[model samples]
Target chain A: MISRTFRRRVWLVLCALALGLAPFPVSAQQSVYIPITGAKKLRLALPDFKIGSADPAANSLAQTFDGVLWNDLYQSGLVEMVSKSFYPLQQPGTPTDLGGGALAAWSAAPTTAQRLVFGNVVVGNGALQVEGYLYDLTQPNKPFVLGKRYTDQPTPAAARVIAHEFADAIIAALGGGPGIAESKIVFISDRTGHKEVWMMDYDGANQQQLTHLDAICYSPRLSPDGSKVAFMELSSAGSRIRVLDLLTHRYARFPRLGGTNATPAWSPDGSKLAFSSSRTGDMEIYTINANGTGLRRLTYSPGVDIAPVWNPKTGAQIAFESDRTGLPQIYVMDADGTNQQRLTMSGYAVSPSWSPNGEALAFSWRRTGGGEGNGGAYDIYIWYLANRNYLQLTHNGERNDFPSWAPDGRHLVFAVGENESWQLFTILADGTSPAKLTTAGSNTMPNWSWH
Target chain B: MSHSRLRYLCTVMGAFAVMIALAGCRHKPAPAPPTPPPAPAPAPTITLNADPTSIQAGQSSTLTWSSQNATKVELNGASVDLNGSQSVSPTESTDYEAVAYGANGQTASASAHVTVTQPPPPPAPAPAPQPSIQDLWNQNIKDAYFDFDKSNIRPDAQEALQADAEFLKQHPDVDFIIEGHCDERGSAEYNMGLGDRRANAVKDYLVQLGVDGSRIRTISYGKEKPFCTEHTEACWQKNRVGHLVLATPAQ
Candidate 1:
């Protein structure tokens, strides 16, 4: 008996050591928490983009660029935007305009913005050119923090693109991590008389249809690099996960695994996909290589286990939805399907989407009402993995579901039921700024890109 | 056949002799002839023809019909316009009759023959596509429903499975797939698991009822594709079911 107890003690120590030696870097952990807990936000002045040409089209392009940039900064939640009314009469249009007088005016007046963002847009021979700059108003000599020049076709879309690029650059320069301004959101839309996959900008611009299969599609998850989308498609044959190559506008060769394969989650490195399949006569979680090889079955429960989402930061663990405990709940397991840990105990929780930093999960939960059969309204909640604490992101008693994280890790896009029509909305992780993103027919199942 | 023909010939000859005798009697008449009553109105006459009277199987033909002096007309026991055409697709050779009626109960009738020829079997296509099993599955199979998130067969679900089993037992050669489905109230992924359980519950019950387990397959649609897209309880109940379809080999 003594030897047995001693062996048990050793085993426990080994587990503790294994947990302690996890590969999570300190810098990665800090990057995720700093934006959430950091209270002192830098106030930044965003003057309108100056129109370089007298052409009316250039004037519109400048307006469009300035509006997109301003919105991106506001959505980042990393900066305080100074009101335009507080701006000095002499706003900077370029780096040369950042003179002592302009800097002193911005730093001293009621407009005391700690930083400044200024840009200009010019239209020429079928091309739109944009010059953007970010200035540290408090720095000695007021050095330019970020300056970028972009050229694209002379269109509002191109203007928005340049603005997004500049906004992302500014966010990164401020040590806010990679910004999601230029990221895309893929979802299922039934606007074209069929449930087909669609894509749009992170801020709901340039909405475009991606698949014309004329068949029902669901749960679109964009790849980490924004080059492909994997989603469940229900054709006459059966339900299968199809990968669409966004760059080529073609279906990349994915093997047709039979027997109801669906809800594919891409690995962080884009090398493999984890999905739930019934190829062996039972629904189980399986991981397959992106090239359609290396198929590995991960879960063995007779109960249902599905909807796997990889940890974007480490890719070492996966959070998925399972009903093995007689009620649907959120569960996490190692990437190879070991070390299964249940994250939700008493509520009906599912669709566990890992935050970009891999430190927390956002999911839909009906936390009350007898688990099932009762009219329990689902709300989106974030469960922090470190402290095992959660923060509810939605309070309205509507059926909000399919919570997916933005690349910022501070915002989530989810579907809400309104007047029997489903729409997608993006809300901050702290339960603020609920912005509606879709107005068309029943847009749902939004998956924000990792980038 | 010869005997009947001889009898028919004798009857026709007798009819001719009687007609001749009547004509002779008319010439020699006048014993007690009264003033002739007003002649009765002529009966209606109808001409019916099926255009392209012969066609390959699955092809359609037009039945063009017209009637004269008719107050009412009927084609194949259905009332029709006096002078109209109808499209008819007959799987086999059929004779369509049209009857017209006039005043004083007078009537006339005609028939059009539409011979439907079986199409020539193509040598290269090998086997024709048949939707019989699919149609039979749709007609005979009944979906089994479960309570919210519960996979155990309820009393109502048991009755449905029993009826399904009766049909399956009679068709031993047929194979089918049980698709487990869920309502939109649950998470798409977890409902997948629930759906799978529901499907397997159905499969297990069928197997217990002496069905060949190998002949049955199961799939989980989860909540991705809801049969009923409403937010009410009735619609959600309709969405949670184990639907049956003919199990063609997966492609």
Candidate 2:
């Protein structure tokens, strides 16, 4: 009912409001880990890798590489990829292909990916060649954030490794730091008719046996530099804490404390080892030099005190499991044994692995008031050091335990179980995606390599 | 009646009665010439002797003992069965004495000195060939089983340990190691500690039974190895045990 002039005025006012509410200038930001205030995922694209060879083997490997790459990026919980349906009409297969308006077209319309990662693969002569390129389209002009290549035998195992390595590189480039792709997970496996130490890639590929002791070896803990592993080995004489030097491929003698010596944890500096020893007439926390000389007793409780993990950040404190209160719970104290404090009040909690940043602890927690027979009764929980509160990463009735924090602090490796067999699984700190890392040999006691 | 005649009659009667009393007192002709104290009981021959009354150092011999006409006997201040034999091992030449008591409160003794001669010097024990801990484990010691996640000695485990203690007592020169184990049901680090407790519990019990504390050491395997691979309770029970290993320098 208004006149033409008044209608035009209302329309102009509406237009001004819309223009004023526009988003921030995305072109100025160069980082992919943006908006650090909330639980937001980065918008990215992972197009199929381009094949460079005419070999039919190359064609099949490309498909596999692409599938693994997509899954790896998705499971990272940091990148939210645009659906393949919404990809740009023209897909660039390399960093050089970002020119000629392909980048402009990919950033427009239904394709609103702010970052792009593309690569090429070649398979011939029993070898596979893979190259990956990452770019931040927010800059619009800069094309190369990183370019990495991998060469290995043309097999499914090598293909998985290549995919995981590329994913790690891309994630490292985007997260403003490093990722866990190049890391290894050490665990106990019974595949050889005896419990032995075994290792696999971060993505659970190329599982190779490490220890041939043909005896029971569990609680595989890697040194801070990943040069050695300390584990519990069973012998007729008793359980002896043994160290295997990965660099020299030799077994090293652990100090014989006479009384039950088990659960060895290396200090942050790699010079001292903290473990639970009953040499003092009871289960007490003890520290010994790595070469096995100085024996210093820490905890004096009549009950058990074990599973000591050093805080990688300050190296001043250690998180451990203790039953001084009748139920095993997580406790923190100075590395020199002072200021002892309980981190968990109730429920049975053990196997505490401190976060790399010293900001949180991850462990298996269960409400110990009974009624836990059904499943999902035990779960992985992270206790934030600042607020003293916790977040449950797994729920329901499935038992999840032995959570070892990745060096990145954003992921954790834990043991997931059903009935008797247990397997290793990795998930983000936010509990978004869970990827299984092992399947053979009833594996458990997974320890992630330190960065 | 004259006084002299009455006195003569009284004297005659008194003389006859006195003679009768004298006859009663002297009935058996001077007690058969004083009977020589029944031949003095023959002085109780003890004959405390050892069969093969000599031994090489570190060897054993049987001590055979007997006594005659004795109510009680003792050897080296310890009561031994009369006329019995016992095996005795002496580290050095030692003298054994047997004292027997007669019925007359008198004692007699005999001594059998077993000569323990030194043999040729043996090889160095540390470097000498001996069974390894693993080998001794299979043949020498018994294993103590535990309840799930528990280190305290259970009833079944105690029965096995009693025999172990007895074996230890019998073999003083041999030491042992107690290995605590678990059944892959708990955290590895925690189980390591728990296994340690189990082994130590056995060691502690052995120590209580007069076994030298230093003779028994303990270690925890923490569910690292399983003797049985099945997932049944029986398999788990096999895993939760304190295995014994004889301690030798070679081991």
Candidate 3:
């Protein structure tokens, strides 16, 4: 038996050598192994950025970048930015600024920070330059995880852009998919006498009016590719779901589904659009090719069916709002409208926005009383598909409605009414960290950009 | 000449006797007793009238009345100023009575009938197109309302629809666009569909009331165009309604 086994092993090794192939397989996965650390968010130490000189402009630029970077990372829903007060007495603004024996011990367990982020910002000769870095304190052997350099005009807006870019790099390292740092939120603003499509940075900066159609244009939905926006514009011809390409600044061709067409939603692949149309004398869910052809009806229910949202990941199911059961509630159906199931039981629910993972839904809901007493007290709520349970994301007051999820799937942007005007607001998916986003005029119907 | 002289002599004798009688009367032939006091005034007379005495449905008529010596006056059991007038719009033939009470504890009433005639349907209006929805909504056309998240017609809104239906039938040329609205509560997407339900609910009622179904166009504004800005129940109730827009010929 020994002689036979030895002969077989020799033959196999000889064959491998003859074929110039390796004798073993390597198992390698490139993903970083980030410990969940239970329910606590990853703690990050953000220190003040260093300025090349004591010049007032340079110092101001440095300060602006630091604040913007901190706010950007803090809102990512993955990190809890540690305050500078909790940092070590010997604070390091840059790798070279570290005191003796600090860089090696950069793993500041005393501050409960597992990671650290800091950079240097310099404004000289009418130009701004910045360098950002991220350090994984646990790995002293190779602590640097990211390094980025950005150069732009020495303006406050440029400083904010630099910070946003750096924050996105850090988010990518943390495995939160592509960061929404450069994303724009296309929404409806009534600042110019008539409601029109407007866009703003993910951080609510650079709010620009995209459509000048001084008519009623609203319900803006950014296509998955972030290049086109489809919305309903009211005209003498009735409400039409029209498409506006941001890059081209022109209305793209759209299928003409007569009657009243409104509340459009883009499919995950951007090949088709789902909307509610009353062309048949009753409002029903319909899908049409993105190029204004191949129209087909999806829901034939007697009650109204509208506001269709597709599951981003799977694309096999859609969630929409319907009153087929005598009250408005959230309903899920197969892509073809078969196997429809109701997801809400109690209060009137609408705007069933599917979570990126297809496991949850966020919708605007309000409890109904004697037809006249809903109080305009609607709030955003999340329904978990797995547990068949629901959670309220907003409390009373302000009448929060129209919750649209950021591409990251961890945050939501919604419209809130206060002082008789509706403005944009965002909150974490877990109902934490609620903050206002718009202030000047009534901003509403927010649809977060795909990127 | 002789006859005239004899006549003149007799007349003179008579005048002398009359002068003696006049002096006797001046002596006051026993002052006549004071005439008996006039009898008590007749019961207060209340004349209640309806101007023109007839009107078509949805048309106004003036109810004018005057009374004499009435301590209190009433119309349809509601106390009103005596000899006052008011405008009444009775949808059907109605008899209005005005009653008054006299100081002598006597009551008097006069009844007037405001005759309602169909008026032969106004020659059918040539079956022409009606006004635009903007005009109708501004002209005080009726709107239907729904419960929160509910598209079903509420019981209270049924009467409003019945009246709306009758109006639609009477003015067949007045094509409608039922604009559905919601309170500033639900998501705009779903609320829009809910609005569709409301508008369709009104359309169904109109069709059942004999108006052609195609004559009604429906659109849902969701909660966008709130008629009231307040967040109170009253404002929300007003916002949650189906505005009846008379369709333009082009629409």
Candidate 4:
């Protein structure tokens, strides 16, 4: 039989050991959070201007002013204007003279009225000056006034310029980015007989011609810095790679490799080049230092290996097309001659261009068994590097080839054959509705400039 | 009467002695208990003299051992095939060991390593000079000229072809593959077809000259296999010709 005192001593010892072995609670460190402050939303009101000149010959001026103002505001996508004809043309009583403040007088017009804009136009000596004031209905004392003075301009045209200037100031005062309504897109158009690189505003205005070479030139690749263009030109001898200095109007040839040379691809670093050469008894992929020395061959198969493109993010690997399997297929190999592997298993594929993000490869593939004329009708496809899944971006039976991805990688520009003439078209990466960007001649092989 | 009284006294004395004997008993000493045996002595420990030692290249060595009362014996190291002594090949050598164990759980071990060097490979064969008909013809035709508007063999050409034919006849199984070529002045397609005719003409002449026609075959590589790089008539004349490839039956 055990004693009670002995049992109590054992229990006390057990409690002490349990308490000594217990784990301590941990405390987390404190962190600071910063909140982002957004700019205040300001509503701008436009002033109403009456047609001071009603001369029959001056009607064009009135129409031009109204047109410019309406188009500018509509394109802004920011301002909402109250209908002028919906309200009666009567002046309300002065706020100080009445028992109400400016806010009460502004709100007295209508419950839906948020702001008010008043303006007047005066024409003199074939010139015009317009002044406008924007008043906030909620805060009567806070009103923004803007004025524009135009000289050496006709009464009709001056009003148009004043309206545009007013819209520009309002956009800037509201702390918004500049409107791109006046920007342009520089592209190549063959509308004037031969394919000549052209530049126009993004809205299709101010078109200008750049290249005048009479020979056949294609595959215009823009430099990453956007100051030069590297393209392929066919002369009496054969195809030669040339670079055009956009600023100097001078051109230099990428050193020739004995046989026909085409498809000049600039490395991501812009310090080297990867191109195809047949000088080694067959068409194989070759890379040369940008200064043209150290020409090393990267592929050694008895097949037509062409269209070498480098991964934009990593200069250590290159993707190209090889016919070693008796048909054109996509292949990838190290920047050096190691670890050569095929990436695609079907169809005659060509013209592989890497996306700027290096996450996908955009190439053109012909439908199987589609021979000869069917060769022209290729579908633009993208291969996801992570999953090896491919998505076709074009559904039209017409030819779609030479896909060049935009700098953002969200859209792609390619040449589409329509009505027997090739035109430039842009489509979303998901193969949604495509928009025709050019309406003229046979324009093919568009390379977007990396800006 | 005196004698009877003495017998009675003796009887009484004897009877008293017998009574005293019946009351007293004699006892023997007990045998000493058996003594227990002493505890057994512990087993003797074993010791070895030779240990596994490394040897340099081209060296040979032996393993030696010593043990105490060992009944079971073995040699364990890099190999058991050494069998007390090992002679390593000159190309490769290795370490060895000797081990012994007794039934009383005592064990001993010994080892030694040996090494050897390797030899080099043999030399390559010499190249042979196998000249073709074109080489022989070019050597003998240093100044020989062909007739105008004709591809017939001249005197020099005949001498060269005869030597080649004689060489072929001596080796019955040997065959020759001939390639005919033309100058670059004529149309490529026409010259290709014409070169074939010139080679056949030569082959037919060889057959009539006692050479087997079955041993010869011809191909035309027209305008492609030019002998001279210049554009002059002299270069063109030399380029318009035939080439021959000779081979043995086993080649």
What DockQ do the predictions score, one after another? 0.25, 0.21, 0.21, 0.00
What TM value does model 1 have?
Answer: 0.72
Candidate 4 runs further than 4 Å off: A1-189, A199-207, A371-377, B1-251
Candidate 1 wrongly placed segments (more than 4 Å): A1-38, A95-100, A125-127, A140-143, A370-372, B1-142, B217-219, B223-230, B245-251
Residues A157-242, candidate 2: write the lDDT tens digits: 78877887888888778763566767888998888888899988777877888999977786889999899999877666555689
- Top-DockQ structure, candidate number: 1
lDDT of each residue in A267-300, candidate 4, tens digit only: 8887777877655435678888767789998888
Query: Lowest summed lDDT over 10 consecutive residues: which window, candidate 1 chain A?
Result: A27-36
Best by TM-score: 1
Look at candidate 3 and give me any clashing residue pairs.
A371-B147, B133-B246
Candidate 1 residue B202 Cα shift, in angstroms, is 0.8
Cα RMSDs, all models: 20.8, 24.2, 23.0, 35.8
lDDT against the true structure, each candidate = 0.82, 0.77, 0.78, 0.57
What would you estimate as the lDDT of candidate 2? 0.77
| Candidate 2: segments with Cα more than 4 A from true spot | A1-38, A55-57, A95-101, A108-110, A122-131, A137-165, A370-376, B1-184, B209-251
Q: Candidate 3's residue-wise lDDT over A1-451, tens digit each?
A: 0112223443454466458664443213211111111246678888887777655788888878888788888888778778777777765657776546686544555676888887787777888999878988777767789888899999998998888888889989976667778888989988888889999988888999999887778689999999999998876456789899989899997766666688889999999888888878688888888898988899989978888889887888888887777667788999898999987665677767787767778888774431224544777877667645455678755577789988888788999878667889888776777778899778888999877
Clashing pairs in 1: A304-B193
TM-score for each candidate, following the candidate numbering = 0.72, 0.66, 0.70, 0.42
Given candidate 2, what's the lDDT at residue A126? 79
**What class would a CAPRI assessor give candidate 3's docking?**
incorrect
Against the true structure, candidate 3 reaches a TM-score of 0.70
Candidate number that wins on DockQ, 1 or 3 = 1
